[model samples]
Target chain A: MATQSFKTYFGRNSRQGLWYVPLLITVVGAVILTVYTDDFASPQNLSNLLSQAMPLIIVAIGQMIVIVIGGMDLSVGAIISLTTALLALDAPAFVLVPAVFAITALIGLVNGYSIVKLNVHPIIATLSVQFIVVGFARILRPVAGGSVPDIVVSCVAGTVFGIPLTVFWAVIVLLLGWKLIHGSRYGLHLFAIGGGVSSGQEDAAHNFGISDQRNVILAYVCSALFAALAGFYIAGRISSGDPGVGETFALDSVTAVAIGGTQLSGGIGSLHGTLFGAILMVLLSNGMNLANLSAFLQGAIKGAILLLVVSLQSRKKMGL
Target chain B: MGAIAANPVLQRAIRVPPAYLVFAVLLITLWVTKPQLMNVNVMGIFIRQVAPLGILVLGQLLVMRVRSIDLSGAGVLLVVNYMISSGIMGDVPAIAYIAMALSVGLAVGLVNGYLVGRRRVSAVIATLAVTVILTGIIQFLASGKPPGDMPGYFNDIYNTKIWIVPTPVAFWLLLTVLMSLFLSRFVFGRFIAAIGENPTASHFSGVPVERTVIASHILASVIASVAALVQSASVAVGSIRLGLEMPIDAVAATILGGVIFGRGDGGVWGPFFGVMCFALLFVVMTSFGVPDPGKQIARGLIILLAAIFYGLSSSEK
Candidate 1:
């Protein structure tokens, strides 16, 4: 019985995916880092790592939402960049914060509408949006300079009852992600839609009365919202808006989602898997930085890791 | 909407590639607005600027026809540029440099093919990852050793003209003609058409689907490398910060030319004019005094509009 249960948990065909594999790798990686480096176990470094990993974890969770429905959003990085730019505009905190979310929602809506109504491919649609958004961001703030609202900064940097705010940030984001991805019927519909897509039956979920189009659109919205949240967090940390700040988040979020044992072909994944995957990426970078590895080499290594991880996951479709 | 789509005249118009129409429109716009700039010498320079992109598009349309993509051109371009300009290759003859660049293209192409065609990985992620790896390596090398000046011969070759047409422009035209002939007159063209129409049906009918896709990728990468050589030659010095816009522009031009993933309705000349559209677009933008950010927005808008055109038409069909 135990063997059967174990097989189901880690099996290739499981809906949970091979998530345990990354979890295992994360554990092994953490142990190795602790043993090898004097600074790895320090509270300061550990906290720093959490803070560094937070934005990615958030963005990956958003990416996971879209990937779950056999779609992608390359515009997330641009959305994040735009968010920071807007926040840094000389405005009141209350006005800037809501304005950011509203703008991102509209962007997501357009992305969803393009994919659903106009029948544009997900990558092409998102890529065009990415360029458009980035153009606007660059126009708004050519370089990174203007200060963010004071309230946003304090929320991210302040401690709560002797615990760092990043810890609270982690708990809240994870809880929300878990609720949206696992605890809701909407999440189930996303899987149904993605399963149909990967299986080459685009209408299977719709046949079941799932309203797949609306769900897919909502998923894109959530993705944009999460990216905006990540942008907000970064704006707080940096205390200023940088037009190019979120340039890498699009690919990084995709890498994180894929590493979490989430199939890029869609239909199978777990929140914990994504969490572990984000942690693994952060861990690898942390260890590499401590070892004095060149930043460029570290980038190449990360790319290799993404390549290796994706190659292992078999898929049905042949194109992007 | 349905009634309009059903009209025979509209249907026929839709079948015609948008590239030709856009090219004509832009040409007329240019002739009317900037009559002085329409001369051969001035026009030749503008067209020559897009020769590298035009060459890259030839490969892009081939792969897209077979339902795959390659975003790794930037990486290949960066590496080739680095090799020639970094002087790390250490005074190699120009021929030797050309051979080395082609070899690098061949290697990257083979890897992309193996992953996309055989392993069935998403072509976007695979090629994008390859680009990231190449970019990282180039950055690392450049950081350790600063980039140096290009050999003067490349610029000389780049500047030469054949009967008032620049050498690069002539070269780009030759490649396009060769590509068009290869696709229309050869068995490989038939294979590409069959595969694009239906991979499974083509495979069952004895077409080597995987081999063809792999070959297409290898050819595309090699073509991109040649474009890179020209691009590197056009510049006076090597820099690590090569624009990533080339591959994306290639995609835009290919789509604007009417060759989308798994469909090659536009054929060679359609995309040829598509490249011409870009050439004219720059002139128009320059005359209008559009800034860099506006140009970026225009690029994005063009791709979106062209894709939507195809998307709407295809869905209607």
Candidate 2:
């Protein structure tokens, strides 16, 4: 049923395949806004849009990996909360900054071990971690008032060649994602582990000596590191460490990746699409804000879009 | 610990549901430290506090038994909560509110069922998205304005007691009993068990897998509305934030009751005690003068422990 629809929709030499669906939607959405609203393509609006996507882009990088690995990390947002809290704590940047990555990586290891070694379901394990970390984040700073060092601010906030400093960071992370997943032989193994595994064949990747467990652990570790970077940048942008910041990154990243055309059930995804997907999501929100839409209404729109993306994407792959 | 758990006698006892053990330990601690809490009347007041959650679990377990999950209870609770507290239906009778809440729940549940059962969307993602949509709708409708007070008529119904038990607690108990009977005596129970054990097998065996799953979701949402009604009444003054955590708590309580995801090994009594354990836990924590943050931490720890225990049990199997 799905194949018939796909062939009809994309035509015979569909090089880009279904990835073009999200790209088309994003372009159409942007085109409508540009024509209807004068300031939609203004310099200020464009810059603001790119900057808004900075932190989310980083978080989505991590989420893309986990989604590819057939697992999820609900604690991603919590890790951001924890990172900012630690960054805001009473300590020098030299001492506290490294602590953020180390601790997040350690937490990621724990998350990975629980899922891989202890055999806990990814959702259950990560959700429990979410509760633990969220409570701790709140407890650490009930009110958001922690100072971010000036040096850290300049590093993440200062611009390069008149563009946002964070955009540079975004580009770097994007390249890294591309290289890791689409370049190296190791990357092919990562995809092999998630993709082409017969259903319920838990160790099918093992037959290829792909080391599924190691790759799963690596996926989580990368997620934590990327989330830490996002938290660091957010703190720098705000000039304060906020426990409340990045609270939506966990689920929103899932939404963004899905919109970018990544399958939630693992395997068959590309970060290239995720990058545009994140931009599209932020653009929609930003566009609505400029339109003077109510925040409440925006929430509804976002949720509805998330549902649509998850369900509609499967129309040809797993047909509803 | 493994050796002890591996013992045949211990295995049978462990299968009795760990909620009892936790309840016993907590109750004993309370007995020694705050014997005043042992009074039946006092216990009734505390039990009333968690009756809503107790009711929600009945639905959660049913959905889980059919190898699906209902995370949309919070969404139903919020919408019903907004309706009653927002006074959108001003000057209406209590039955009107009740009907509206149940209907709202039924609508949401049917959507969830159709999405998961027919469309084959993942249960977690569908239900979660439903919650987000409902939350957004409530937020949009409220428009940053706090909700007004709940009508007094519902509160009166909430307060009414037959004998010493509060009306809400009694309602919860009655529902639990009815659910047990429904699952045990009816053909639906067979469908649930068959589907839960093996969905494909159940389908091949002519168990009407899709219908059973959808029916369970419908039941879950309707019951969640009942829970929401009780919750809104207890507060009297409406708050938008009441039910956000209830679904997660319901899942935790269900797990602690020994009903792992897609399995109903503990039965209703275990979850009954699971809800009791939560009530007692709050009582004990409050008595000990633990602050709200501390209680939140303890709650997280309990959930993590449950997850860890589940891992242990599954790995052992």
Candidate 3:
């Protein structure tokens, strides 16, 4: 957390500077917003910021996993919507929150099956899931429904030492993700599969005693779980099961993962970067909001930022 | 069983694309269950609804043929719709509106082409960014209020009928036929096929791979402009949210037509039928009293089915 550590960490004028772009953005965005308004940069305000960004961070973690596996999921947002709808319709009654998570994992399993077993393109397969899941959500609740259970609400919004419990949830994801990805052979296999995405890297990993398909499937299942959790968080925040809450998450999560310096082409990046990337995205929009920019203009700014960041990162990869 | 599986003629017939089969099934189902629904007047009106999608598929197929995609059609359609309907051009003549609308497509398409083809950006990211930018620009301009109505002349063209078929449907069919013919007869079509088969090999063979990609994007946009005009005219009023579904629908239809990225075994008419399948799906859903959400579910299933079909075909190859 010190500038002294940063000095040795990323030397000036390094070719690998793209890896630090998201971190730089987070710093710059925070500074600019803090300068613009006294409300920003405060501990409470920062806590509020983390709470607001918690769901996307969780969702982006899932996305980051999928990207590490050399694929994408257009359905994560819809999965969130579907799970929330399940909770809205049956929570405190028929379907439990655990059941919602189960259903979401099942959906993710289906997505993985289609891609790995059925040989469907990841984009196409997940897109179909997106549509089906979103449609199912609408069917479950044609309109936003009743509030979530009180326990569910407190579980996310509750505080630990004046910080949102949601922050702890995000931290758990990051910490667990790090161990799962970096500390174990499974992570190594995942990165290997990503390195040879669609080129039979699975076979290579298989020779390494890693069940490639299972890992791919696990990545998807993890993503769906987080998305469903995001739905839980959103349902708590809004106090309703609005099927439309996740309209922006699909692209936004992918954008976060991409900006975090994860290779869209696979075989690069870290959970830490994705975590920072999600914060940067959320902070960018939050800063724009504090600036009192029009909602329309804010959208343009976010879009431009996403486009600019990704292109820059990709350009670096191309040695441009 | 071996003979049945291996018979060349039977195999050829089976390979004639699934969209046609879906169309036939829907038509027969309607004939048996609700003959009254099959009448030209009833079908014509519904078919008109998909004419824009049919046209958009033309462009979708072209770029997709070059191993790239253009989701920016939705963006192009949005900007053109806003321009023609918002009266931003202020009472321009109909032809002038047409020109302006197409120019928007050309402009957006060119940017998409340059980024994807020249700058080597991923087609999905580049085109997706273009859509984001256009949406932002329009949202900024509208500033939260609903846009105004389009000209009466546009609506008149939308609803017009020529000899039992709606004008839009006729236009759609003509475009389909012309595109099919063009792909068969033109040099650019050969270029598209070459680039799609293998960009590096095609380039080494002097196929002008990069230019073909950029040209395909430009052409796709021009075709998308026509679709936008048809769509804007259909709604009659300038609406803020329109044409977002076209990109997905266009991709689905193209895939349903057996036109995977960089491959097109299902010629243009196959996708024309793909468009009709959507039209027919609506009729079937409507007759069954399936609501909007149900229709959405059906659409998703079709896309999934198309993906499954693409997977099967690609692996078989």
Interface RMSD values, listed in order for every candidate = 0.9, 3.7, 3.9
Which of 1 and 2 is ahead in DockQ? 1
What's each prediction's TM-score?
A: 0.97, 0.94, 0.93
Of the two candidates 2 and 3, the one with more favorable TM-score, higher being better, is: 2
Over A1-320, each residue of candidate 1 has an lDDT whose tens digit, in order, gives 98787765677577778788779999999899889878877888889999999999999999999998889989999999999999999999999999999999999998898888888999989899899999999999999999999999998997989889999999999999999998899998998999999888999999999998899889999999999999999999999999899998998898889999898988988888999999999998988988899998888889888888889888877866
lDDT of 2 by residue, B268-307 (tens): 7888888888999999999999876667677767776776
Worst 10 residues of 3 chain B by lDDT: B1-10
Prediction RMSDs, each to the true structure: 1.6, 3.5, 3.5
Kindly list the per-residue Cα lDDT of model 3 for residues A1-320, writing each as its tens digit: 68766653365532122457788878887888888788787888988888888889889988888987778888999988887778776447335787898899998998998888777878878888898899899998899877677777777777888767877887787787788777788787778887666343446666767788888998888888889888888877776787888978988998888888787767676777788889988887887776688877777777777677666544311100
Chain A TM-score for predicted structure 1 = 0.97
Assess each prediction's global lDDT (C-alpha) against the native.
0.91, 0.81, 0.81
Misplaced by over 4 Å in model 2 are A1-17, A42-44, A196-198, A315-320, B1-6
- Higher-DockQ candidate among 1 and 3? 1
Candidate 1 residue pairs in backbone clash: none
Q: What is the clash count for each candidate, in the order shown?
A: 0, 0, 0
